[model samples]
Target: WLRAGGIQGRAILLDYASWATAHSIPLSPFTSQPIPLAHLRQLIAERSITIRRGDILLLRTGLDAALKRLAPAEQRAISTRSSPDFIGLEAGRATLRWVWEQGFSAVASDAPSFERGPVLGDHADAEHTLHQWLLAGWGMPIGELFDLEGLAEYCAAEGRWSCFFSSVPLKVPGGVASPPNAVAIL
Candidate 1:
């Protein structure tokens, strides 16, 4: 995957933070806020976005901005939690089905993981979550902890959410994961 020109595709941004703010919905990255499949469709319909095959789905859950505002102690607390929890895409059979049907090349998010963290006890159908299915089942790439706030700002200002996205992962043979040098061109 790293050797091959990497991943290049039409990327769509679902600005969940903006949607939640506009609707007076509360969200916290420290909590298990699952971005529902229905809500994703809602955003697509509301923005009149057309889904296409091989599209890279970018989801902004406001986690980047939220973490930026926290003090050092608060950040430390989150890092040191016994069973850390944070905002992420909802996990379940339904989520898996929708993602497969959409035919996304890969999924990326600003949260710590593409799917919710601490998947042991919190999520229903934890075994069928994205981390397991995307990585193990389909060999799909899942980008996490991406700094999407700047992208969000730019998109909001320009009223354009679609862009050309690319990323070349670190060239580590047989590596499970690697931080990517990802870029998006508006």
Candidate 2:
């Protein structure tokens, strides 16, 4: 929908160090930490990433890679955890505002959901999830389970966070979701 709406633009990758640290721990895949707004701001500044209207934001949380390392049983167990958790953007007004203020056309991450799981018990707005706001309210497309390890490494080596990202989803009428056949070019 973003493409159809002419919302495509430069893509920026946010590579958090936690991804690497968590990958070294075998059981870390079962849980995720929250990416604070302050930390996000610092990362953007430190990486010299310039946010523009309609840009696509790709967050590298390493959840995909970590899950790949887990045993089948471990994966199944984590998948069914009550109130499952994973590292992602924190749930709050600040996060919602940050995303809106940035004017991103879409947001993608290596985590399962774009936002932290087991939604915060004290969140001001309990009725709506980030998914609801981003996808339903803002009409912003959200991508999850993206394999960004290679992209992150390349960006780090070249010190370039922005890229030309293109994705082609299966054209299925009435389809609610489809795999993201995506590519990123520096």
Name the best candidate (by TM-score): 1
Model 1 ranges with Cα > 4 A deviation? none
Residue 107's C-alpha lDDT in candidate 2? 95
lDDT of 1: 0.87
Candidate 2 Cα outliers beyond 4 Å, as residue runs: 2-8, 18-29, 120-124
Cα lDDT of all candidates, in order?
A: 0.87, 0.78
TM-score of candidate 1 on Cα atoms, chains taken together: 0.95
Alpha carbon lDDT of residue 132, candidate 2?
79
Report lDDT (Cα) of residue 49, candidate 1: 85
Top of the candidates by lDDT = 1
Q: What is the lDDT of residue 134 in candidate 1?
A: 89
